[model samples]
Target: MSPLVQPRLINGPYDDPGLILDFRHARRAILFDLGDNHALSARELTRVSHVFVSHAHMDHFGGFDRLLRLSLHRDGPLSLSGPPGFIERVEHRIRSYTWNLLDERSADCVLAVAEFDGTALIRAARFPARRAFAREDATPPDLRPGLVHDEAALFIASAALDHGIPSLAFRLQERMRVNVHRDGLAALGLPVGPWLNVAKAAVREGAADDTPIVIGEASIPLGRIREHALAVGPGQSVAYVVDALGSPANEAAILDLARNADQIFIEAAFLDEDRDIAAARRHLTAGQAGRLARRAGVRRMTPLHHSPRYLDRPDALRLEAEAAFGSEP
Candidate 1:
């Protein structure tokens, strides 16, 4: 079967932790943890409307400024989500920069920041903060396991885990399903046109009616129109996890979020030989990261957020992780 989702490692141990997932067929795209994002050009950045940050670590957040700067006057609103202190961190970034250029620009951009704090959620915004902005806490929502953001087709879910501090793992799922049977359409002497829109609306709303679907003045029963387009397909899911120590207490929570992910991006800062150092620093060794991936039963695991010390020996680190996961290359 053709893969429903495609993931490109924008930047990683080879550079910074940036991944671009092309949900083109699903009518959306997602960027996970904006590290050095040179992999994505200005054109690609403009197309992405949703970004998920794993934590505030420089490698993970450094490219955010550039992303915001590039998309300053774009068409749609940008939605950013992360663990606690995310809103404050973003506001601090905006305040630290000069905004004269933003003010003069024609783009009226709005930043919506969502932060998860276990039982409650907080959200706020800054219009390219012109002055020294103080962090304001907004009304919190119940942070339970369900759809957090429900846009037209995009849905997001999050769960909190301890990383010496509050850290979060986010999953973005596209709930729109598109299906059509070519043979069925051919047999019915129906030419596919805008009638698909009515069928799609019915599917999305889960209701069917006897309304006549007029295609260029030709009428067709909604029930017959539904037959050619009614089919159920699987949705796509991508998970991002970073900077959490692999602990028994945190393992379940992390795995529960990562299990069965089509593409899982996790951190592997140390090798198994340095397990002690990893434990002391609250980072995961390559082996530990692989074990977690195996436990979560993910399809593909990309290990990132490497310590600079292993910069010259990245292959060694990668192999160590692959070995732990019983995978080669």
Candidate 2:
């Protein structure tokens, strides 16, 4: 099945840690972080409906001001999720500016801030940064671990991790695997028609009603339509993580989500030579990021969030990380 979660690193090691996940097919697109979002213009920025932030660090959240300015008048609600104090920080940013210019504008923005408390293992979302919605204090409520989004073609799961402070990792999954049942269609003397689209939707929705399926004047009971006959296997899963340290407690959480991730995006803010510095700063070195990716059994590792000092020889840092993880340069 074709991958539904399209990930593009707008900025990071190559730029600055901005990712645009196009779940266009699912009718929703998500932006991971908001560092240097030069890759996304005003028009492109409005395309995203949700923004998941790892932290409030400057490099991680500097682009939010511009994003807010662009999305202030959009039709849809712009949900923003992040660590604790995120709402206050965002409110402060907004209050810092005078709304006299924006009062005339239709600010249809409904910002939702989700904060994770590691000690409680719970996540809470605050609407308008004041009103609290649902709260989960149990095992870190599975934010769509299974059929979370339930859109026609996509499902998304969000998991929290410790990045010095509270942080989160999101996994976007395509719910259905689409495949042509050539043999079944041929056996039934049924030429592939647009009705197959309805059947695929039925399979995804797990619809039980035996609605009559019209195929060129022949009405066939939908119950007679077998799923495996026209269905494929599982779809793809994409996981994104950033600004996290390699700690035993967080390691398991990170690995569980990243294991088998087709493309893993992680932060590597320091080099192996600066391991001590990385540890002190509660950040991950390139080598550590690579090793964790290998340990997690990720297929592809894109180490990003490099410190500015390595700007001159970024390739050197990348190679060092790959070598440490036993990956081909």
Candidate 3:
């Protein structure tokens, strides 16, 4: 099955931590953290429809201004989600700028920001680009657990971690993956075309078994297509975690949020030699990140946010992580 999200690291571990999740098929993308995102082109920036923040740390949010400027005149509304104080942070950024000279030239652009406490959205606000980005309180949804944001194709869940302040780790999972078997299609004598997508959708949506599926000159039941050419199973999942302390509470939260994740992008900001410093600064070390990935049973681990202290011995972190992950050098 084709992946629903194609994620790439925006910067090296020594720089800042950021990830770009390209949902190119949908013509939209999601940004995880707002660190130095200059690596992404203008077209890529404009494709970002939503941004997920891990915390309010400067490195995690420094790219907000760039994102705002890039989306200032875009047609679609931009949304931001993060831990508590997210709305205020965005509002403060907006207030820092003056827009008195701007008018209807860019009147339709809007920005929505939501603050989540664990899984519940505590506060929400919207800023209209045309109106100088003024804050407007919006109705809050009922307190929910597990899921913070939901979309038709996938859902995002969060868990609060200890960063001295609350930090959130996010998990993005597709609803379900529907794949078409080429052999089955060949057996059914159906040509591979756009109609396959319809069949896949039918499988994803659990359409009625007897639903008609037209292909070329003949019509077949959706069930026939499934039995012949469609395969459905659990969808793709990726987790993003950063700036979290290595503590018992944080361990539990990270494990729960990132459990069974296909890929875990976490902070390994220090080496085990500086474990004390990492703990003091509320950040994870390479060993700790590997331990979390192991305990969570994640398929793969991509450690990031390495501290500058390890610049001279970068391989040490990778070795430590690989050791904890039970992989040979």
Candidate 4:
């Protein structure tokens, strides 16, 4: 089965911390942080539907302007979720820019921002290009706690950790995976088209087997397709975490957020020998990151956000993380 999301690191471990999750079935993407993202193309940033920021640190959110600039002329809304006080920060950033040239004829795109306080969004707002990106109060959606974004297809869960401040960790959970059999479609004389998306949604939404799926001029029962052409499988999830102190509270939060995730991108900012420095900076060591991912039961882990101190020995971080990941916590 084809995976729905393709997660990739936005920059080298020592540069900035971020992830770009490219969607496989649609022209959409989700950004896990807005750090220096020169690595991502303008087209890629324009397709980003939402951004989940870990914190307000420069290394985590300095690239906001690039994303905003790329989104200005787009035809779709750009949504963003971040830790407390983030809504104001977004507004301030927009305010710092001159919007005198912006008008209704400019674009219909809106910048929807939400501030999540660890558990759930505390406030939300909308800034439309038509209104010159002015801040307007909006009601937060009714969603379960810890869920920053929720939709029928997937949901984003977050857990805030201590880093001298709240640094959030996120898990992108795809609701379900739907696989289609090309051979079965050919045998049934059905041509490949957009109807497959409808069928996949039906399966994801648990539509009744007898539900009639209209494809072209003919209506087909979902059960027949379920048996001959389609299959349902477990969904995939990717987790992102950075800059959190290595403490029991943070560990518990990360473990819960990343539990059984297919892959986890975590920060390993220091070596075990630099434990004192890491603790002073509220960062994690390579060993700590590995053990945390292991305890979370993730299938694979990518150690990132390496401090420049080990630039001469890049492999040291990877080796330390791998060794700890393979051992018991």
Q: Which numbered prediction scores highest in TM-score against the true structure?
A: 4
TM-score of 2: 0.78
- lDDT (C-alpha) at residue 233 in model 2: 60
Higher-lDDT candidate among 2 and 3? 3
State candidate 4's TM-score: 0.95
Q: Residue-wise lDDT of candidate 2 within 167-263, one digit each (tens)?
A: 7676666676766677877877778888888877776666664777778789776666654356556777777777777677767877777777777
Which pairs of residues collide in model 1?
Answer: none
Of the two candidates 2 and 3, the one with more favorable TM-score, higher being better, is: 3
Q: For residues 1-329, could you state the per-residue lDDT of candidate 3 as single tens digits? A: 78888989998878889999998477888999997889889889989988989898999998999999888768768989889988888888878988886566774778888888896888888888777777788865554486778866888898889899998899998889887798998998889998877877777787999999888788899998899888788888999999989999999999998999999998888888889999999999999999999999999998888888878887778778878877677
List per-prediction Cα lDDT, in the order shown: 0.70, 0.68, 0.87, 0.91
| 2 or 4, greater by TM-score | 4
Worst 10 residues of 4 by lDDT: 320-329
- Give the TM-score of each candidate: 0.82, 0.78, 0.91, 0.95
The reply for model 3, stretches above 4 Å from the true place, is 141-144, 180-201, 212-220
Highest lDDT: which candidate? 4
User: Residues 260-317, candidate 4, lDDT per residue (tens digit)?
Assistant: 9999999999999999999999999999999999999999999999999999998788
User: For each candidate, C-alpha RMSD in Å?
Assistant: 3.7, 5.2, 2.6, 1.9
Displacement of the residue 74 alpha carbon in candidate 3, Å: 0.6
Which of 1 and 2 is the better model by TM-score?
Answer: 1
Cα lDDT tens digits, model 1, 1-329, are 22344667787575677678776565556777777887788878777767777678787789888888876656456777667788878888877866654443456566667766643456655442222223444453444444445554556676666678766677766565656676777787777776776666666565565767777768777777676645645566777777777788778877887788776777788888888888887878888888888888888787877878787776777777777766667
Clash pairs for candidate 4 = none
